[model samples]
Target: MPNRTAVHSELYSPDSADNPSLNGGRCRSCGYVFFPPQRYGCESCGAPPEKLEAVQLGGRGTLHSYATVHLHMGRDIEAPFTIGLIVLDDGPAISSTLANRTDEGLAIGDRMKSVLVTASTDQAGNEMVELRFAKAEGSK
Candidate 1:
């Protein structure tokens, strides 16, 4: 097996491909959960930065909305990709790139789950995996 690494090590775990989780922060005072793990302060309770603690948020969610991108100016990802707005089962809503290139068989209320997909290979022969959301099996 080739070497594998996460595209964003700060966002998700590089290991645990079978059960992926996002690096999220929770406020100890007010019990608010947020993604992207911020250390500034709790948005819900105005607690200090010390009140925030890192937590693992599950990668299961419901698709709230989605859009297909036909125009992109970034070199990281090509155009004709799909982005989905998912309301996570834990608490936060995150916008993740869909595994499918297009939104052919997607719906607003469909169940979605996180998946690791190969984005590119580095010069060192490491497979760079990116966390993406895909329509869950047997979900409508």
Candidate 2:
């Protein structure tokens, strides 16, 4: 197998493709948890930036909603890709690209888990993997 690299290194680690962890932030003052971590003040309360602490959130979540894109203009990805809004078990809802190319058998409230999918290959022959959600095993 070729070497692998994460597309968004800051968001998640390049390893643990089977069971990934999300880089999130929590407000020390208001206990607000959020993903795609930021250094800015808490959006829930008026907590200062210093009160925000980095956290490793579980990559498991519930599929709240989803949509399939049939058309695309971007060069990075093609059309017929699916995006899902998942509410993490820890807290906060995040919209992420789904591992499935299309939303065929997907349903709301399905158990979801994170997985790394090969987005592209780097010039140095490294696989660029990106985090995406998929229906959990044995989940109906």
Per-residue lDDT tens digits for candidate 1, residues 27-140, read 999999999898899999999999999999999999999999999999988989999999999999999999999999999999999988888899989898899998988896
TM-scores, each model vs. reference = 0.95, 0.95
Deviating ranges (above 4 Å) for candidate 2: none
Model 1 bad stretches (over 4 Å)? none
lDDT of 2 by residue, 11-126 (tens): 99988889699999999998999989998799999899999999999999999999999999998788889999999999989899999999999999999999998888878899
TM-score of 1: 0.95
Q: Candidate 2: minimum summed lDDT over ten consecutive residues — where?
A: 10-19
